[model samples]
Target chain A: MIQIENLQKEFTIHHLNKTLHAVRDISFTVEKGSFLGIVGKSGSGKSTILKSIYGTYIPKSGAIYYDSETLGKINLVTASPREILHLRKYEIGYVSQFLSVMPRTTALELVEQALLETGVSYEKAHEEAIDTLKHFDLDESLWNNYPNYFSGGEKLRLNIARAVVKKPRLLLLDEPTASLDNASKLKVRESIEKLKHQGTTLIGIFHDLEFMDGLCDEVFTMRKAVVNAYEA
Target chain B: MHVEQPILQIKNLSKQYGAGCSNCLQPNARLEKNFCPVCKTVFACKDVSIDLYRGEILGIVGESGSGKSTLMKSLYFDEEVTSGEGYLEDFHNGSLNIFTQSGQQKRYIRNALLGMVYQNPMLGLKMSFSSISNIAEKQIAAGSRHVGNMVNRSNELLNQVNIPLKRSKEPPKNFSGGMQQRVQIAKALSSNPPILLLDEVTTGLDLSVQASVLDLIKTIQRELQISMIVVSHDLAVIRMLADRTIVMLNGQIIEQGLTDQILEDPQHAYTQQLVYSLL
Candidate 1:
């Protein structure tokens, strides 16, 4: 569970001395296991909000509270870098819009590394990675291929599989299906649906309203630095 | 006087994306698959047909993406319908399909015939507009040009919803969540539309606040006799307000009946979980 209160985030262009307000006093709560979708047009700060939740972009004001089962409630905004790192490694997972290309690493190794870092055995990690790639409908031939060699959609699905390999408690996605075609999108939706049914809390920014409508339990719309939310 | 016909009639409505090909060309064949095997089309809504009588509350209960909101948005002209017909008794002689109407005609129908209360008050209320002016905007949209009449009607509606006259001049940004919702309700009722569509109106509110808003809604429904379609995931909200209920799962209505009968004897597995969870 997470509670974001009066969250404000801004980016400063030092050269121009101009401050870009990204999130302005937005407050909302995401219940555990529920999917919260953030929808907005381009430049509406939807991704900024996701980044803030992911703890990569600290808010200029207000607090983000995470109700962890083991650690109790912690303020993410004020959380130490180590604490944030630990949360990311164990509790929170993020899938960015672009895949961070690992030139020499295969897709299987990339996903297996996520599990290995979480203390899973190397053999177990490999097996799980295979299953995850299959769930994403990634072809068997693509598992040993480098992300750079994969198509845009293949890379995105690999990114998703890697992020969700550990089955983190909360998963943050920025345009999860942005690069996929209709069939691939459908495949990814099935994977997301399976994850949801398994009780993984999801927060994503989807410009595709119809996709978001079908996937999200609640949706927040960002406009002019303010946010308004509604049930899906 | 004779009983009036239903204000809204939806017939075999289906909203799907992509054109089906050979393998999935049969009607509703796409719905059985995760995605259409032929075209990869997703079914956002499927053959949803329902009617809203003149003065009755029709509740649509479902999990997210069950097509409940899509169904409402289609009626409000917010989402375009892919197929099937809908007719509003008071618009275009009751024979013209509301879904097929031109954008201008749809806008006219939305302004004069329908009122919507969103789950979040911020979506419905202009936070910077004075509470009175928020109500006035709807009246003005319905072609009320006289400021005096608009203000009078705004005040009357606000009073009916129990929003104080003193706060009517102030913007809604400073109001509490419940007050903001009440203001949204007042604004929605400003034009005295024949039909009101509510999407999870009490969700995310504190229990006491939810009760008060529900009470206000009940009073308004009884006093104004406006036809309604209320969509919610919460069964209790539906039980408290709706006369009839439709249970939806994955873009299809799994069950429909009187609220009491459906709750008492839920036949569908999903409806059973929903009803039992409420208890």
Candidate 2:
């Protein structure tokens, strides 16, 4: 479960001598095992809010209270770098819009890395990564190949598989299906639905309203740095 | 929350190439690109600090003159640090500063606890020495006296790096650029060091070769669980190998965080430029 109160985040462009308020006084709470979808246009601060909760961008003024399974309740905004790292290792899983693939790393190895970092044994990580990739519908032949040469949709599937392989308590997806085909999108949706059924908290940014309508428990429409939430 | 201690900890590590004047020695001295305009002092590495956790690759990315290589050299004891404290978990229970150790102690540490792979094969490997001898040389330095054991270990290391056993008897000068670099890596791993310092390891290789070398580094880290400090001007290489990345500018760390964070949402202007350029 996560509670974000008065989450205000701003970016200062030093060279331009201007400050951009990405998110201004947003508040929301996601209950345990619930899926929250954020729908917004470009620069609506949807990704910024996710980044704040993910501890990538430090909010100017806010508190993101996370009920960490290991460290108990802690404000992500004020958590030390060490605690944030620990949370990232064992609790949070983030799938950004674009897959940041390491060159020469096979798809299987890339997914396995997530589990390996969390202290999973090599054999177990490898096996789980394979299973996750299979569940995501990635072809077996492509598992040993580098993702650099893969199509955009394949890369996105690989990214999702890597993040969800370890079954993190909190999973943040930033436009994960933005470039996928309808069939690929369906595969992603099924995988996400499976994760949610397993009690994983989900907060995602989606442009496809129909895809989100079927999955999200509530949809929060973000416009011009403001959010309005309603049940789906 | 419980925190894991860094396997290698560096504090205020500074390596100066010239003597400093009073003006340049000030804590707040504004240097012209890591150089003192008034004192003519080249501060190759200025008050650099780093913490390398076990089983992680820490990347140092900077331009050619950003002192990343100097930091690696200092850590490997190839270059003397002007001032700093370096503690290794395997060395005296991390209580002693390695920078202040005696020459013999430093040699012992370098031979047993640390391994270095230089960008230039000529610098890291002997042209006349056979590949097996080059690797065996490191094991021998680490106090392995049995020739039979050294040969077996050297052969195993060469195999790990993908060098053919038949070619292991050939000198490095007879090998290709990529092959020579693989030999250097094999030599570095001969002692089974807990920490590996790689200075521009894949800088000059072909793109395909670079990928293979990077892949080898990743696999080695996973299998050996060695903490590594990988220095390069190439952000792509850093992205591929580093778990955490430190962006250095003018001998100072401008930004550092998880490699994914740095790639996706770089905060500093210099880092933004670097990431955008990669795009």
Candidate 3:
């Protein structure tokens, strides 16, 4: 299970002369295998919650628990350089909304890099990457081509393949289906469900209401940077 | 609703080149319907002709590479249309053939009359400026600024979207994705242009934000009485707001009808997949 308690994030804007509370005392949880949807208007601090959980954003006050493993201790918060590498190398996979693939990189090479970072064997990484590519149903012939030539949907799926190939236990997808067509989105949704069945926990910031209502096992609604309520 | 008086009109709309096209399984050009030697294949949006009515929200729904963006670009693009004519009926009422427009005409259309909103708010806004300044710049550029009007309007827009007014003076870069979007809208409305072209306006928002933004757009359209043409891959947003829908695949409008008919009982195979894939 995943649990968060009383998280707060404040940004001091010098030019604006104000302390903006991006997130305030927000908390929510996802039971194992539960697909959780976090939904809110822009600036709702939904992204802050994800960042805090992933250790990207340090909250002023809070506790995060991943199945009784205390995730909020100062030691855990101030992870060593090696430990930071380990955090990214294991446990979690992230796919962001903006297409952030490296410039001039081939789709294959992108996934390959993710594998390399995780310390997987080179030949084994190639095999695993191929399997993940086929799993997402991306065109096999285009694997060798630069992502510069890809469609929006194709690029996003490629990013997903890269993230999921390592098979991280927890996956965080921000705006996963934003520009996807209905057909492509349906396929991606299927892959996400398959991940849950494989014991992957998911936390996504989504805007597609029907997808959230149908795909999510539960939903959390946020207002003023906090999860106001949880619905099943 | 007489079809004679168009709020916005697209005549022989086409955007072509040595092909600055983005690669996809589909194409993104609006050509003269199905006649292209390139790709040894079809043009993206072939000679598309459509009329948007005042106070009506028309949606352009297409898969990636279907030339929806290209079509949109041809309309409100900073660049004038390569070939074709678009007549605006309400504000800046001009018979712009686009093909034969002077540099002044192109600049005029880019600055005024045509208000364009993109998917990424941060990418759209000027990061150096406060939200208030962003709107003010748009007003000054469009030559339509009100003294203290921007501050009042910016705060109102922030409140409308449920953001605190205290954040109104902050650089939009500091706002959340949703708040930045509101800033974009505030800027879009700064000049009070009668026609708004939204290209995936809610693209990066979370689900609740999506619903709220879609609703916000719907509400804005009604309150402002501005004609809107929204292009999106999300059929739900189109269904919720658009009076009319056009379903495009491979630069072709396979189906066009009332939003309810298209959503509930679509005619095209592609349209069926679009609606069914919603779940």
Candidate 4:
């Protein structure tokens, strides 16, 4: 479970001499294992809200409390970098619009490495990585290849694979299904549904309303840099 | 509907260790892998074959000593292959066998058309050199001499990996595990090769850092549409990034299929065990 209270995230454009209010006193609560989808027009702070939750940008005021099972309730807004890294590692996972990978490493190694760092044994990591990559429809032949050559949909699958390989308690997805074909989207939906069924809380920004409606238990429509929650 | 041609084709590729003795060569002789029970030999890879299309991500999943790494090493010319043929469609109408090329020709093909990323960063990066220099090194080797062009390209690649311009001057030794990996990625992309080969890239980073690096790879692939061959023991990584997957056991491809089909309806007992363990 997560509780966001009066979250205010402002960005100062030093050259422009202007302060942009990306998130304005937004408050929301996502229940355990619930799916919360945020949608709105462009630049509506939909992604900003997710970044705030994921700890990319610190908020000016308000507290983001994560009711963690391993570590008791910790305020994300004020958590130390190491604590945040730990949470990002073991508890929270994020899938953003971009895919960035090491130059020389293969997709399988990338995800396997993620599982290994989480303390999964070498053998288990490989097994789980293979299964996870298959779930997203990534071919076995490409697992050993570098990511520089994958298509748009293939890369998205890889990103999702890396995020959910360990099955974190909280998963934050920012437009994960963007640029995917219908078949690819269906594959991604199946995996997300599986995660939901397994009681993992999901928070996502979905430009596709239909996809959002299908997956989210609750929806937040962001407008004018604020979030308004509504039953889906 | 447009049918796609295979960008790279691997046919009946076999890599054997030690000399094949007369007993081992006998049609009825039963040999223990590369080593004949009657003689001494080792088979790293046996009659392996696959095809890679343009803009496709192919995955190879296997256990340790399954010859998965051997197959990759053979493809990249890191290891000597005993037999079989490999061809790139773009080169000489797919008539040239990559394996038979001379050392100079192989080096040119590797630098100009193929990209290989190893499991360890030490193999891919110069830890003591600045990040920009590391990327520049590859370009320089590829015959680019203009510093201005190289700097711009390096900066663009670094920016894509979320490395700031200010940090470009710093050596990868000073960077975090994830950052160093990103530097390696930028260096790999510096050449802009048609096909990229990666081996066990993210095995050491934390989950969060791994996600960032994976995300970076995703962005590059989507934006550039380069073909890739990824090797890892982990199925989860294969699931996310591969379009087609091959299962390898004991130097042979046991099962090959679409990633979803392999996961949801595994036919082979080994694949079933691999899938079942994930749950």
Candidate 5:
């Protein structure tokens, strides 16, 4: 459901005001139900690609097509902000790399917020949020509790619930397994497998080679700013 | 012969906190001396004795709140130990009692002699600072007089962890979790300190990144010959890295020995259970 053609993004450092070429002409395509893992060391442009796909960072040169819809293609890139702006949160659900959940929000509320943002009705969002939380082993009572009080594993589970509650076709996940423990890690792996089984296309960045090897069907390796072709 | 200098010696370390107020190493045991006049809670650390030698990684294997962090925090002077003293050389003096050192003195030694990396990398760095500047702050905070070369050193170390120079100027908050962790490791090693304490440093990284970072830490330790204390519940990581293993349970050390002794030939019942469960 996703296709990228020679994407490049350059970031200018604020302190030095120097342009650092973070990503240099990287491109790949993911079928409707494929699992893609982008592997790279720090600052290897793994997160930038996901952000670009999610519309957080507007790449300087590149065209992204999701199921025939242009995400970052010049047509939409130059399209008035109003045209592409509404498609982001609705079309692409992103699980941020760091602390995805806010301190004040409950697990249920976070999931509900995601669904509502995508135009789900209030009553429908609430019902879907309950199902999402229950599937992840988050109890109703604890769902009402703020995420700050939840354990690291609980927070990660909530983040996954919030991102996947919408059941978007394209999911951009940024290190979804970082905070989980051994047992919870197993649970998360199973959950991702289920999501893949349901035909939700995924593009995730993970450092855990073992976990990534098991979860990702295709691995994208980037070294020194340039990306090699996707490998299975 | 692996001759080791006794870097830190823990003698009868015990700490009590919260409700229950008893030194109950045995789950059902009831003791009177364990009670405290404060919050009237049971002690968390119980008569813990261990010796950390230089140039070796001491892996503490335990569940959460198992007194591993407690011992580390007290040894690093981040927390106060209720009883027992940790003896260590003062670099110049014959030896210094860790507890006897003043707060400022302990802070100085803590900053210079020890480096701590927490599980969450976000908390470790200033969110606003770039990867280079985050690492630079560690050496600067350690009271190092060399300021001009800090950036250069930062670049080199960040490069060491595979963080590119291009992202060196970008705020670490913008980096991925695995990338942020690499930056944290780079910062921890900036000073090239002697003893390092890592509490779940690889918790937030992907498995592949975890292996790479673990290898990086081992390489750095071998190059610098620094004593390391790695505390984590992941036995696979500890088994792959540590020279010695300490099995902790409910605020007590159930077993302490070489990795082979703990993993292959366990002596304690608790250690046996832990090793067996891992299989």
Candidate 6:
């Protein structure tokens, strides 16, 4: 339900007086309900492509065509800021590699905020957030604890749980399991697999080939800002 | 998706502290840190526009002298706009520009449709007035005449913000910093305004007290569904509370987006530094 065509992005470093090409040229499409995994080294533009689709980065020249369930078919690159914001709220969900924990916010509150911001009732959001955290194997005792004090794996799990709790139509994960132990990784995988089974489109960047092998329908390898996709 | 009009819309709002000269009158006048170097005009807020949706908390974040507080003050009518338009869905069906309203009309709107909690408790609450009287003062200004009804409502509001009944009769001057802020919140909510403007409500409180006040604000938002505009220099408070965030620099909005997006991947260089500094 998403199409990327000739996506090119660059960063102009003013002090250095040079433009760094983050994504030189990349194009791919992900069908509805299918999982796409992007594998690449540092600065290979894997995250850049994801950020473009999420409307965080404006491509130098390209179109990110997304078939939003709410806003019809729209090019994310050209969509109005309000429309992009609306889509981000209701249709697209992104889980970044690092958890940007808000100080004074509890783990449960962080997850519930995802639902709360989208107009979900407080009681229901609270219940669903707790259930999602439990599904991600975060201990019950940590529910009220601040995520800033949590272990890396716990924080990652909490981050994933917060994003997936709302069940957006499109879910973008950036190194979701990077800090997790094997058991925690399995739990996160199971939760993601469940989301995919429920028809949420998944696009994830993973360093673990084995973890991605069992999940993604196709793998796109990026090298030096170029992408090559093949069936898993 | 069906489009929803913003509960409050501000367009091209500008507030300046001095008379403009030829050098600063130009549309593209370059200012030295939000002040005109030649004319000595301080542009506290320049061409600021904002949209606050129903039941959402919109955050304005910037460092001191960035004019975030000025923007909040202008919206709450504590400061007059130099030029701009403000529309509230509850005011004249969103057809009237509130900035141009008559003094009486402006007072009516402020009393009925808007609530503001200042950063300093002294600015928002009377020092010698009992907490309940402070809240009742707002309800009375909003046209509540029955003393008994006003008292009950004030008690309920005080309790809602976690003020104990025993302390309700005490003046806010006797309260702790956090408690004074809570009382200020109760006073602001007394009018049952559709929109609430809060300026650094938890800025000076202890860490533990800050958390509780923040928690109280979140709970109040969920329960009351009041659209709020929160102004603070603290990005952490904005991240915890704001649904959408606007980043201000030198009296102008440099960047704005979903709070998650702003914190995750800020686009502007200034915003990048602000977000990175948080790490």
Error of 1 at A46 (Å): 58
Please give, for residues B138-178, the per-residue lDDT of candidate 2 as tens digits: 89889999999999999999899999999999999999889
Order of all candidates by lDDT, from best down to worst? Answer: 2, 6, 4, 1, 5, 3
Error of 4 at B11 (Å): 0.8
lDDT string for model 6 (A118-170, tens) is 88888999899988988988999999998888898898888888888989899
TM-score, every prediction? 0.53, 0.94, 0.50, 0.55, 0.51, 0.92
Give the C-alpha interface root-mean-square deviation per candidate: 29.9, 2.6, 26.6, 23.1, 27.8, 3.3
Q: Name the weakest run of 10 consecutive residues (lDDT summed) in model 5 chain A.
A: A73-82
Cα deviation at A140, candidate 6, in Å, is: 3.1
Candidate 6, DockQ to 2 decimals? 0.33
Model 2 is docked with a DockQ of 0.43
Model 3 agreement with the true structure over A26-131: per-residue lDDT tens digits: 7666787778898989999887777666655555676766642223322323343223334555777778765554334578877876786556777988988888
Candidate 4 lDDT: 0.83
Q: Model 1 chain A — which ten-residue stretch has the worst lDDT?
A: A10-19
What order do candidates take by TM-score, descending? 2, 6, 4, 1, 5, 3
lDDT of 1: 0.82
Model 4 agreement with the true structure over B1-279: per-residue lDDT tens digits:
134468999998988777878886666557665457655777778889998877768889888888988998898898989899999986788889989999988887777788777777788889899999999998987778999999999999999889999999999889988888888888888888888888877777787786676667655675577888988887777877876789988788998766655775455677767877773
* Candidate 1 interface RMSD to the true structure: 29.9
Candidate 4 per-residue lDDT over residues A51-125, each given as its tens digit: 777766667789999997766898988875445656776889999877876556799988997787676788999
DockQ of model 1 vs. true complex:
0.01
The candidate scoring highest on TM-score is 2
lDDT of 3 at A163: 84
Per-model DockQ against the true two-chain complex: 0.01, 0.43, 0.01, 0.02, 0.01, 0.33
lDDT of each: 0.82, 0.89, 0.72, 0.83, 0.74, 0.88
Best by lDDT: 2
Q: Candidate 3 lDDT, tens digit per residue, B106-219?
A: 666656777788887765699768887887777777765576866676667667666677776789778778777877887887677888889898887898777667767866
